[model samples]
Target chain A: MKSRLRVLRAERGWSQADLAERIGVSRQAVNALETDKHDPSLGLAFRIAAVFDRAVEEIFDNPHRTEGPG
Target chain B: MNPFTTGPASREYQLATAGWFTLYGVILFTVAWAVDGRGLAAPWVYPAAVAPALPIAGFLWTVLRFMDRSDEYVRAVLGKTYVIAVHLTLLLCVAWGFLEVYAGFRHLALFWVFPVFWVAVAVTGRFIRTTR
Candidate 1:
């Protein structure tokens, strides 16, 4: 999943650590989300979206057209 | 406040994980010693090792029992670490079994493997947090 987490966090002048603390996850998880290397779970996605006061769809995007293998 | 011990109802989850750790350690030592010294078949060792699944199930049951309204960052991180370590440990142990049993190689010992895996998990988890 691709996410606008970094952009949203930056708009609020928050460091990755700051955002992570607010959302109750590690800074690396936030960094991974920003880099699109990891996809947050639904609960985490909701938490991130809540922190930015945006809908989950607005923050996260499915970059791939086809789903990968299980 | 430490949610693990004092905050809300999550202390039960913490205690359960600790209990699982104890069970895992005890079962591993007993099974390892029994299978190594005695005349038990190597295949029987598999069933003994699977005993840890009981504790793991108990731990997860506790986690589900007290799903708090607020997230616990520490628990989430530790839980992820535990999961990743378990996966890597299982993979390495299986690979070692195949190499030693099937291919006639017995280079790695259990003592070294256990400590290496424990340290690797800690180092990897810390690296994930500390890297700039």
Candidate 2:
């Protein structure tokens, strides 16, 4: 899964630790999420969305999903 | 709290852990000395022998507090790691049990359980964190 967590966090001018603290997670976790080394669980995706005031789908995308022709 | 866990531990938790272990160690030494030198003649000897368990309880409390202080992502990572650790530990223990029963091997000590579980968790966590 690819995420816009870095973009959203950068827009807020918050460092990884700041975002981690806000989200109640370690900074290492935030780093892992931004680098796509780890994927977030549903509950974590919701938490991240809540932090950014965005829908979960807006933040994370499943690259494996295919789009059908309109 | 007692130098365990990958996540950070609070100062109070660390202090309590250290203090408890120090006390536990002292009590353990005292018990061993009394048993060896003077024998378990006194009524208090039995209670003194088990005093080391108090620190184990304190260590467990610190572990709980450390987990509570960690963020959700860290907790999730650790929770998954714990599951892996449990599975590995269980398999090792079961295999060892079978070996003892079928092959006439010496019985293993119960105290090796936590060490095996934690070691598995540490190794698995490293791999999980590094790999996609």
DockQ scores of the candidates? 0.08, 0.39
- Candidate 2 residue-wise lDDT, B102-126, digit = tens: 9998999875775687579667766
CA deviation > 4 Å runs, candidate 2: A10-14, A37-47, A50-53, A62-70, B1-24, B41-46, B130-132
lDDT of model 2 at residue B119?
A: 76
Instruction: Write candidate 1's Cα lDDT for B3-102 as tens digits.
Output: 2344445556667767877887888778768877675676877787676456656756766665443244445545566567767787888888899988
RMSD of each: 9.0, 4.7
Which residue runs of candidate 1 sit more than 4 Å off their true CA positions? A62-70, B1-113, B116-132
- Model 2, range A1-70, lDDT digits (tens) per residue? 7888999999999998899878776677788889876788778789889999988878888665576222
Docking class of 2: acceptable
- State in Å the error of residue A61, model 2: 2.2
